[model samples]
Target: MPPTPPEPAAVLARPHTAELTGWGRTAPTASDVRRPTSATELQRALPNGSPRGLLARGLGRGYGDCAQNSGGTVVETTDVDAFTIHDADPASDTVLVTAEAGASIDRLLHALVPQGLFVPVTPGTRYVTVGGAIAADIHGKNHHRKGSWCQHVTSLHLQLADGEVVEIGPDRDPELFWATAGGMGLTGVVLDATFACPRIGSSRLLVDTDRAADLDEVLELMASGDHAYDYSVAWIDLMAGGRATGRSVLTRGRFATAEEAAPAAGPDPYAYSAGVLASAPPFVPDGLLNKLTVRAFNELWFRKAPVRRRDELQTIPTFFHPLDMVGGWNRIYGPQGFLQWQFVIPFGAEATLRRIIEELSASGCTSFLAVLKAFGEADPAPLSFPAPGWTLALDIPAGVRGLGPLLDRLDELVVAEGGRVYLAKDSRVRPELVPQMYPRLDEWRAVRNRVDPQRRIRSDLSRRLGL
Candidate 1:
């Protein structure tokens, strides 16, 4: 049985704690945080009245302010962790799994993969929570072949802003269902969800790697080869110039069958570390990752990953999330941290991409990690960010002068080319441009207002963008 809810007054006056965005590191602020271990406690902590204000926070993996609230209450959902394998249909080759929103995808996969099952979708990092993944409608390398995470979700147990706990799915409250998928927690707090899991043969990924001479070559490879693999992604050397400008290394992979699988030799599957469990030191020297250092790193990475080859016996973590193994890795960007800029431009806007890449090169703002991927069909969610196009993601340190203005210019270019930024990783998109990027903004707002008439659902991002 779950524990009883805590009294609302008991949580008042409690110290506010900020998240790991590192934004608060240089200038710290606080919020009244509630870490409820059960749904009863969750209900008790919600604000009272017609529109109860609250925000949900997972692992704090969101790059910007999406998971944060300034003065309002924040419900830390990490305590609601639980996972149950409902059924495994051997004949149908599908697995039905139910997990509390707080369960981390990495932890869940460690357990599922050994049993020959895998989540249908996963972001670049497995550290994200199931609830966070759904709220953001995250897309993986396989997005070209599969849709966003919402496409696999069978049902969601949500706690509405008004304190009503409801079960919503395709068959029930379909509008609320789609809205909550990419809703960014504006609709309600996700309690738990059930989704379909794909069957896997082994823990290894059969990978095919190749190098592209430029952005155009990268796109051509993806367009021609994406269907042959379950997962595909390209790492761009943003600093490369002239004929080698936008040079990239593309990797495509699929689950290895028993006949192709190698022997496992590592820590027991269930005992793997939770990942980067510690934060970076309070202060880091500035200019630690400036142009010179970044350019050198880019050269090494591109040269190391040869032109074309096949690599066998690849571990799951090395293939899907190489960054997770390094603890306190964000510190590499120094104390100011970094901003991940990810935007997608439609297929016909090749010229727009060329212009954006040219600007980055001219400015010498070489992103250490620049990834390019192709997006397939668009999701139905009003706020979903993916579509049939090419998406580029770059991690830029925040301390650079004129960085904000450059981003604003890029935003203009994106808007002009019919592109949109990912809200989960954004902190600076203009409010007016948001409606333009998301045509269904008003529709989502209507659904949100209907559920929380007083506009209780709020967050730093929501308040900043007027969502």
Candidate 2:
């Protein structure tokens, strides 16, 4: 008997007026949030002629306004939950999977890890959706080995402005494919995509840990030793000063073998578990994350690391998504929210990196979550953020007395050094500086013009950066 056709998507829920903000919780904007359960409904909800256009929003994990549209329509894609995992062939090293735009990485890991499979690339958190990963072209600690997220993507199904669905891939529609890879949803709404996942021996990582005395030592250590491991990252102590400024704890690792995990993590080596341990109470007083408090936290964290350690078994969640253990952790920054400033300077620009760190330390900026990593190669996606360079990410409390000016100065330094900020984490970058930071901006715009001729798909970040 023929399989009955799936029911057509129901009429999308009416747009509701709601105040929306990114994960950073900064620059909240009012927009009509439209709940679309499927691709057909999403196409119906597209604002073709409305003064304020439509933007597709995933799990709202983006740190900035790239997924938001002020005074416009925001189509919530959470309901578009289509996911399927194909049985892997006995001879293959990869697993094939198909997922809708709204399926979060957390969901994928839960389904695949037990089967000895894992995503090719993942950011600091697994709450991000597959579509968000592609749109942002996010990289992970393994960027020095595997490229960005889109590198492993086989193809994507996109819904264009005219309500037409098209299949695009690197070879099929090279121009459009590259444009939308890191286009930040400006091109159209991503419906679904197929990607390859590598099989893993276990869910735990076998890690080596080391502590660096200062900035130069840390850089030298990472450069000299990172290639020996599949993944690498460094937790920097921004509050330290004098000889200790830029001190860091470096960790490098790969998936642990079954034998390695049995001795350390118990018998069920493939078992995966993650959950919120606590929640931050809302309405906390402002200035709760003052310099003194953050400095103390940084010191305690730095001092806790082992001077030198090797092959410590750590669960996937503990190693990759530590922050996810606490629900609503962002609230700890207080009501004013925070800004995640992430920028990348090319290999030879280490001097600029040192200068920025010195300025931040001197300015007494409080950032307890500062991290530094090295990127290997860049993909062809015009707007993709990663490159062969050093990338630093800092979480700063918003509305700091001189933060705006300080960030502006940092932007200047980055641009002068031929570096660029990650749009997925940026809320306040100058429009003129974008083109300089991303030399291929014109190419991406040309593709956007062809697909969204009427400029129907837009976002706050698009307008702010003049993309």
Candidate 3:
């Protein structure tokens, strides 16, 4: 008799077939999307030894192919969300929260804030899932002080390829744990995680904003004063040239006290609400965000900001993720989509940063939504992106001509300066340079190979980068 197919209960956990893409909407590919509702279901979902393999996917927030596997299985973890919050841990001083991999940071905030707690780290957007956050080891504006997401993660429950579940953390299987932190899901599927959740007084941020004349002024201000603030970020005018090149608006802040938020926010100091005002139209014409329009917008944005402002009250959404206010914003990039290139260079490499900035400005590249932040330290994860340096993130419409060559030259410069592109946000990095950029790639591969020697766990990104 022929081999039996996977049982209905094993294979049909909300099974479907579709074409999927990351948040950037680039590199779309077909996959079998399986949404397993529980750990037990997920354990039985994968076939014994499928060639295409399986990769876990969360909210699809990554701007690259890390979460996508062409002609393979994409286990959508959204249905596995379950969480519990503990007021205090007897063994430690911090509160404890065990959230399933699928739990989104936005939902966690809704549940935790009422009880006076907040996540230790959050990226530019709260839409990210707990699993995605761990896989990427995301850092936020406050990374200088608190560190990456995995720093706060106490433990993880991972399901291996051979149909076994294992618990790993800093104390037990430290190598595997650290590798999994930013291993891009090559190690195993992260089922759930236990992390420290810090208590907070209010949800508002008391912000101070300063408009710098150029890149030098902005970097100097951040390097000098960033230590005092819990969070800091700068929006650079990439189109500006000459004396005004790299002009930016720097904003820094800390969570507000209940009293500080009362005058304008009224009662319920911990109130949190994020709503989308509008969605970008489904079909934006190609070339709509061309150099002329973007440059004009950049100038207006830079000119309108206050030269300096203090004690400005802002909502969590406004301070961390203004882009969330507009749903389907990616659609604004047109059908061809857009790609986000985020890279970090060590502190002393400011000259290289300046050269890149000059190149972008002179090339007439229109990236109005560019951001610059100062990263304070490197974490233990080998594949983790941040370091003690300056990091810049900007979006480029994929339709732009000659873009590939421009980025290739930029990559060479970045690699020369000991900088690495963020895999979480990358879609076009050269495979040959990955190892050079991440010196510890072999170390991470060793751990991954031990757990998944057959390479049953793979993705488009893993293949592209030869991971």
Ranking by TM-score: 2, 3, 1
103-152, model 1: which lDDT tens digit per residue?
99987887888787888988888888989998999999889888889888
lDDT string, candidate 2, 148-194, tens digits? 99988889998888778899988879799889988999988888989
TM-score of 1: 0.92
> Which runs in model 2 stand beyond 4 Å of their true positions?
1-13, 47-49
**TM-score against truth, every candidate:** 0.92, 0.96, 0.95
Q: How far is candidate 1 from the true structure (C-alpha RMSD, Å)?
A: 4.8
RMSD in Å for model 2: 5.2
Model 3 C-alpha lDDT versus the unseen true structure: 0.89
Candidate 3 segments whose C-alpha is farther than 4 A from its true place:
1-13, 47-49, 89-93
